[model samples]
Target chain A: MDWHQLWTIISLPDNIPIVGMIFIIPFFTWFGLRQGFANDRLLEKLEGDPKLARAHHRKTQPFQKGWARELPVWPYLLRMEFLAVVIVTFILMVWSITLDAPLEEPANPSLTMNPSKAPWYFLGLQEMLVYFDPWIAGVVMPTLIIIGLIVIPYIDENPLGNGYYTYKQRKFAIWTFIFGFIILWCSMIVIGTLIRGPGWMWFWPGMTWDHNRLIFEINRDLHEIIGITSQPWIGIFGGLVVGGFVTVAGYACHRLIVATEFTRRILGRMSLLQYAILQALLIIMLALPVKILARLLFRIKYVWVTPWFNV
Target chain B: MEASKKAAAKSAPLATNGSNGSRQLLGVTVDPQEIKQKALMDLNAIKQPTKTEVYKSIFRVKHDQTARSRTLGVLSNVFLHLHPARVNRDAVRFSFTWGMGGISFYLFWVLTWTGVLLMFYYHPTKVQAFRDILYLEHDVPFGKLLRNMHRWAAHAMVLTVQLHMFRVFLTGSYKKPRQFNWSVGVILLVLTLLLSFTGYLLPDDQLGFWAVTVGTNMARATPMLGHEGPFGPQFGMTPFNDVRFALLGGSIVDANALLRAYIWHCIAIPGFAATFMIVHFWRVRKDGGISGPNRIMLESEIKPLRR
Candidate 1:
């Protein structure tokens, strides 16, 4: 193992946030879900006993008979805000003092940075370029992501978990978000930052980024593999394959949506339009990982190719 | 000390006698001892600064431990008034909310101040930009620290903003009345990313230059607008007149791109983000404060679909 290579990547000042995210995301996930599970257990107890449910405050937080249910924001909430600011300031100060921000040589159009990457946050999009065309990965995907996030509240039909954390109550919503954010987005960024090296080649952690290395592999379009070599016919066959994949994925999503009685009820609340939008977004989201696996395992590049675009 | 003691002794009886010890000066009757006592009372009020007129004028509320005073303490101040007079007691707990939103705002404030300071030493021209950064690192006092803090806080802001969105999603805080605010928040998230991206190009170093080069290169594939995008050529788009050209102000990352990035980073985007933030916070209160550590509802409570 090239420990020095691994250390060099890890110790790069710009990568600190990703390293921090590796720990922070998991810690906060556990922290949040722990509370969620605790609330679920309490919910079970309260649901079984009607009398206690009536008397109970219904929150996991401790409450006494004489205590006020609300507190003034002045000393109570403001103090917490002040403390958070002070703590953040301290962290930033220490970080700034210890590590210097990166500055390479002056810009020269003649010389290109090998494996030139975008900012760490945009690294996810950069990595997406490997699997799809720039139009899809760069333009369309970002626009869709923002639109999908904006429409989340309007589309989510579940009402049980509103204003509180509960895995049992919000199983579908929580799992979908975890898959999108932690698994897909964050993991891509980490991969782009640490694993992808010179020439955008994949190097396992602790492996040297050998600039001279080359891999001899041939990637083929789905139609090419199927031995079709004509314009309209090739386009028709690829479109059929894409359509089939979508139909199958849509059915799977439908099954998952109606998996439990609670989920079925939630699904019932959604309008037909809402249901369609949700399915469309979910299928597109699922396509990312499916495409990544196709390229990695099977050397498949494009499933669908047309005069205008390839997918 | 002797003069004050003699004056106190002389005024002692007269102060107690009230109007009887008053003497005429000009057309109005005036008492020196009474004036002395009034001045002493004013001095005492000054000692308790909160009771003074200047303090009261600014605060417009008492600082006592009473509920009314406490409520007014937050409601009266322009900065603190963004918060409600009171909040759900459980909402104050760190575990409930995680305080990421507030930390994100604080980091923005830090970035703004540090950014302004760095701007004083920076130049957006092709030749001067790199030298200015070099000068900042080696010559300017604490300039390295200033630039470092700005960069790190920016990274921190992006992380905290994501975590804030994650927490909001995890708690299902975007339901019902909060749907619109959540949309506003998504816009703010985009603005935050754009702000950071624009700032990346200001140093004119290879790292930023190439990062930006790779970034703006994506615009070259924006279907209808970019030259290399599908059908873009059919629509008469080219390297000189495409969306990428508009973004970079030229065919390549050059002096014009640096200036454009500087303007967007320092002026335009911050303005938009701040305006959106105002709406976000306002809607948060209108939507009934922070989505809470509330009682979990049961499955049986699910209402039937309308229509």
Candidate 2:
């Protein structure tokens, strides 16, 4: 591509190229390489190669005695800090030159933009507003996220994967966090910032942001799609559906994961409250995938939409 | 005598003997050791160069492999206390920490400095805000660069903070004694977002205005907390008493909202973030310098060989 074409693509709205530089490409590289290294160590351990294991130790941990090498922070940590500063300074200078920050006409409350957007970081929550009402998407879900993030450390008890980068050892935590962050959070932000256009319609990359055009699709609630009425009894049945699903899924997961007597005993050691909270979190996480599928197959807008709230 | 000789050797061997080692600066022979000793003193000391002691001080500590030197090198400095004196070799690896935290801190400083400078040129009012930005572009020298730097640095800071949190999670650094610090980090992350959001409204441009409008409208739907939203009137929420009113100081994004954003962007949010950022870094040291693969790797090394 020509330099002009390349620059246009690089500086596209949401700065998708910058995202790759700052996150996407680097994340996969680090994760992929680390996973490979971990596998190699596992293989060496399995093969009973004492020398290879020692070599691995030497590569990862040079200090034979203590866990740390006791290198002075002056030139080690501080040096890295200096290097990071220089590198960041260089990047910022180039970015500042290449793209000026967006400055539209003076804000007129009377004349709203075609598709006004929140800051890119909040696009996930904004995208949630498309699927649910304001209360649940804006307030309830955000509050849950804060509480969930804070409680993670206290809830996790398995100490095998502390202070390490072992994918196999900490698969549950790693995968769950990745799914929550990349899929639920980052992908939604990408969609909200890049794809959503005038009148909040989906626009592909090649599509123009034409205000005159109207995008149409039928969006329905789960009850309507399933041929049910929105009466009190139907609402109760809907609640029962969710409750039953959770119970069945939780039981099956327990049976599958807690296979041995030893494993069951270990799980039984957890406090009742912790176990309950964990099950609720698992249900919420699993519900996202189900919600996405429901939307795709039946154009479901919300699974539960009460007078006060929607989910 | 032996210690002095060793210190001299460590500081500079060939320099001590060479004629070029000691030079005349303004007709005075400049002693490297004396300069080092003077540097050891606190900032309060304002003695003349000649008046300061010529003896070796802690700052004169040359390149030595002793534990005390290593510890003293970090402890004796005012700026270095944020970091542990001695970190594990693995902790300083580029890919390990990814230097995201450091980059975030650097970007914060850049934004703060540029924001302060830009404050001299820009005003917060609706009438003056847009005009001030235009003036900054065409009238004020280097104003464009300063504003752009502040803007981009704000964006970069947000990105880096998220990346730092991701690294911490990916490495499983937020566990046990570090749990509280992780919560503090979460607060800092939220505050970073808040800081960036507040700054977004300062330009008085259409992008920021409509963004603030759409964003604050989301607040209006805050259940019983907003008057105009779904469940607010069911409770006692009124136009004057709702959370949206509390945030905007009125119903709409007007002069009050703009002023509040300016104050928050300049002072309040940044102040809160700085306080929490300090705690976050301090907790990292207290919980053991940047969690490493050391513990697990050591375990693997010590484990009996198995086929």
The top-ranked prediction according to lDDT is 1
Q: Which pairs clash in the backbone of model 2? A: none
Q: Candidate 1: misplaced stretches above 4 Å?
A: B1-46
Which stretch of 10 consecutive residues in model 2 chain B shows the poorest summed lDDT? B298-307
Per-candidate TM equals 0.94, 0.82
Per-candidate TM-score, chain A = 0.99, 0.82
The TM-score of predicted model 1 comes to 0.94
Cα displacement (angstroms), candidate 2, residue B101, comes to: 1.3
Per-residue lDDT tens digits of candidate 1, residues B1-307? Answer: 9999987766553223345777654435687778999999999997888878888788898878999999988888899999999999999999988998998889899999999999999999998999999999999999999999999999999999999999999899999879999999999999999999999999999999999999999999999899988788988999999999999999999999999999999999999999999999999999999888887787766677676
* Model 2: DockQ score: 0.35
lDDT of 2: 0.74
Model 2 sits at an interface RMSD, in angstroms, of: 3.6
- Candidate 2: where is the Cα deviation over 4 Å? A1-10, A13-29, A32-68, A248-269, B1-70, B228-230, B297-307
**Model 2 C-alpha lDDT per residue in residues A1-311, reported as the tens digit of each score:** 24544454346634643455446635654764484367447744744766665555534444575555557787767877887788889988987777777778988888988788888888888888776677767877787788888878876654545666666555566766877877788788777876787887876655666679965778987778778885775576667777777887788656644666534543555567867776677676666667667776778886665665556
